[model samples]
Structures are given as C-alpha cells and as structure tokens.
Target: MNDIPEPNNESDSSAPIHEARLWRDDGWTARVIKNEDDDGWAVEMIKDGEAEPALVGPWTMGRDKKNPKPLDTGAFNTLVKTASEVLRRHEQQLHALLHKSIAVTTDSGTINVVLDIVPDEDDPYAMLSATDEFGDAIAEVRVAPTFKLTRASAEAWIESGYRKPR
Candidate 1:
C-alpha cells in the first residue's frame, strides 16, 4: 500500500510515521515507489507541510532484484540531507536574484546601495536604497523591477542628488 495520505498546511502536519517503504520524521517523508519511467524503483523526499516532494530520484534494487530497497535510518537520513541541501541552494539562488548590493567610496563617504525586488504577479516592482557608512538611510525610491544596479548607476544616482533614476 503506497497510498499514503499527505497532510495539508492548515491541518495538523509534521506527523511522524515509520513504515517499511515509507518513513516520515524530522520534517521530511521518504517514500520508495515504482518508477513510472522504467521497471526500476524511485524514492521521493517530501518536506513536511509541503504537498509536493522536494526531491525525487532513482532507487536501488534489493537482493531480489524485483524489489526496491526498503527505507532505513541511514538511507532516510541521507535523503533528508540531500533534499535539505537542494532546498538551501534553491533559496540562495532566489535571494541572489531578488536582492543586490554594492558599496563604493565617494567624497561624501562610503555609500552602501541595495536593490530589493518584489516579483508580484500583478505588479512587479523594486526598491533602490542607499545607506551611509554609519548605516543611516540616505535615500530610497521605488523603481521598475527590471532596474539594473551597477557601480556606475550608483555613482550617477549619487551625483544626481539622489533623484529618481530615469
């Protein structure tokens, strides 16, 4: 019986269940199931409170060849580690895309600039801001999400008396 019911976000999630081919613990569930692509098996690692699995990959065959390797503490731990790393990398990439920062020295002082983007479905936008060396906000303005922030642009903005970039 591979038909394990998944818990929804609003309900009581994060339950722990340990079975032969299905194991749930530590905010993740590991399930070994038949691979739809081939006669081999596949394992999926789903984080608790999430409907979709975070990681899915081929599984090793057991001694019987026809059977899938059962879930164990060691295997489950490895899967959790891998899936966690995958999520971490994805988050890092997203942060890199949504946020940018640059620092430069001018006659006034060192200015730290940052661009934060909001990827709204209906109204995407970004906020371009700058702070002095003492972490005092110098300027902040809303800009198009497509705004490109660079050292030259920062210098130009500073030279323009912190006016909205054209």
Candidate 2:
C-alpha cells in the first residue's frame, strides 16, 4: 500500500494554510506558513549555499482564530537571527570540506595563504582562517554560508579585493 498521502485538492476540506515570506539583507531567508491539517504554524529556515534547510520549527498562534500574531518588528528580528545562525553552520561545514592552499604572486615574490575551515560543533558557527606564506595568520573570520560560493561570487570577491568575508 502507498504510505504517502496524495495531495487533496479540496480547498475547504482542510484548514487554509496561510503563507508569508521572510527575507533578510544579510543572506538569511525563511518562510512562515500555517499548517494545513491543523491549527498551527511553522517557520522554515534556508541557509546560504545549503542544498537543504536547517530547521522547520513550529510557530506561535495568536489569540484570534483567523489571524496570527502579526509579523511585527520583533518577529522579523527573531527570524533574522535564527536564519543567520542556520546559514553560519552550513558554511562552516562547507569550509571544512574545502581545504585549499594557494600561493599568490604579489610584487614581493610569492606568499602562501593557507585556508582553514573550523566548524563549531556545539553551536551554529564556523571559522575561516587565512595565513601568510610564512604560516603567519593574516585574518580570521566567522562566516555564514548563506552567501553563494560559486565562480561568480569568487570573481566578485577578487574584484572587490576580498574585503568582505561572507
């Protein structure tokens, strides 16, 4: 027997699932949606550069039956924080997988930049470190993977002098 329940198209047969989009400028994204089978809500967080979402936590219901606690400033702020964390964790993992060391041809001969990705096991945090040719640390940064790491992004970073560590 088929275990998956097929999509039932009867609109009024189930509770209406309300939809709302949550977006952030700092590479965080989420969607707050009402459950169709029950009187509940859920929030889905999608991190940057991740193929799958990090979390789908339940949302709070408002006093009124027909409406939810408005998506006010507080709500937006909380969502941003949650989504950002998710992205950070995702990036940390990718950074770990991306172990690369390269030598740059600067005016003064060549300098080696060692790239390291350290993942935060307890929390949703990741660290990227860049070391100089002599193994001296140049810069270290905590990154959120919500930013794309494609060739386009790489080219953009190079063009921008790699000032921003996303």
Best by lDDT: 1
TM-score of each model, in listed order? 0.90, 0.39
> How many residue pairs clash in all the candidates, one count each?
0, 2
Question: Which residue pairs in candidate 1 have backbone atoms (N, alpha carbon, C) closer than 3 angstroms, thus clashing?
Answer: none
RMSD of each: 2.6, 14.2
Displacement of residue 69 (Cα, Å) in model 2 is 2.0
How would you encode candidate 1's per-residue C-alpha lDDT over 4-64 as one tens digit per residue? Answer: 3344447455667677778888989898878989989999999877878889999999999
Task: Give Cα distance to truth, residue 98, candidate 1, Å.
Answer: 0.7
Q: What is candidate 2's CA lDDT for residue 90?
A: 77
lDDT of 2 by residue, 1-166 (tens): 4222222357332332223344333343455666666767766665545556577777777787554444445666677677667768877767657554556655544444434444456554434444555777655556563443444544444445556665
Candidate 1 Cα errors over 4 Å, as ranges = 1-13
